[model samples]
Target: MFINFIWLNVFLMLCAWLWVSYNKRAGLVDVIWAFGIALNVILASLIFETAPLMVRVFLAVASGIWFLRLAWHLLRRYCHETEEDTRYANMRRAMGKYQHLGFLAFFLFQAGLIVLFSYPMLALLNIPMEQWGSSTIIYLVVAAIIMLVAFWGESLADEQLYRFKQNPENKAKTMDQGLWRYSRHPNYFFEWLHWFAYPIIGLAAGVYSLWIYPILMFLFLYYVTGIPFSEQQALQHRGDNYKDYQRRTSIFIPWQPKE
Candidate 1:
């Protein structure tokens, strides 16, 4: 089942690579990746009948809502923006003649990451119901609450940024209102926060490896793909305004702005 799931993700990402190559819009990979994960979760729940029905249902519904919302949000942005995202544009420029091949590798890497993050869900489904402890209910409740908060925060942050971008006057200005005032990347903070819920949920099924989700997400968001690229782009476009925004706002976690 797990091997089949990996193959499914690879197939979907391969299609995404083809679409991106044609459109020269690598940003759409994010949308496809999110949808692919949701699809995989739904399929897994259907196939893994031996798992606890309640657990399966919770995983499917929660993951479906979270990932689908993100995918739709990204899709809307992809439709609105005429140019490739600066990050991917930069990568493509750096790759030059090998850009297509490079993106194929990048897309495949995303597929591998999807599989890695699915570890918690798959582990839970393989565990017998009788193995789940009494604390399972408590964990589920806590996980649900965390997921809700993370989802709401991410949605609100994205909406705020989208509306800010829609205004012609705001084109070169840094967004520093609402959630953006507290964190430079509130959306990313919420994204990372949501991963914590999975580890907590995994605790119910004795899946220690689930902790890797949040850790890996933090590493990628903070250092690798998320903040570094975004900050560089912002500095390039908005110059000192973005630098000042960075000074006044926390990079990931929400906090009181600097005076």
Candidate 2:
């Protein structure tokens, strides 16, 4: 079943790559990833009989809502976009003659990530029902709180930035109000925080391997795709203003901004 899931993701992403290659809207990669991961997690819960029905139901509801919200947010932004996103546009330009092949590889990389992240969910859903204990409740409560905070934090940061950008006067200006005042990338921070929920729950189920998700997410956000590229783009457009904001704001965590 896992092998089938992987093949299906690969095939779906291949189709997505074809569409993106024609439309030149590479941001659709994010929308597809969000929805695909949600579907994968929910489907795993439904088919995996090792976990209790209630636990499976909870996992389905929580993960479905979280990823669906993100997918919709990305889709809405995609609809309003007048051109390809700058990141992808730059990447394509860099690729020059090999743009098509490069994008195909990038899309397939997203497919691989979908499979990798889904492993934790699969592990959680496979926990035997009889293993539920007093500690499980404690872990679930903590995990639920983390999920709520992460959801609201990311949503608020995205909405705040969206509103700030909607103003014509704010073009090329850095956002320093609301959550953005505390962290240069509050959205990315909360996104990394969201992964911690799984590790917390995994403790109750003796699934220590789940801890890797949060660590992997942190690395991805801090050093790889999240802050580095975003800050570089900001610096390119906003110049010294973004650098000043970076000086004052925390890179990954919410904190009091510097004077």
Q: Among these predicted structures, which one has the highest lDDT? A: 1
Positional deviation of residue 144's Cα in model 2 after best superposition, in angstroms: 0.7
Write model 1 residue lDDT over 1-259, tens digit each, in one string.
7999999999999999998988899997889888888888888888898667888999899988998999999999999998998879989999999999999999999999888777777777778877888888899899999999999999999999999999999999999999999999999999999998888977887778878888999999999989998898899999999889888889989999999
Clashing residue pairs for model 1: none
The TM-score of predicted model 2 comes to 0.95
Clashes of each: 0, 0
Give residue 207's error in model 2 in angstroms: 1.5
- List per-prediction Cα lDDT, in the order shown: 0.89, 0.88
RMSD of 1: 1.3
TM-score of each: 0.96, 0.95
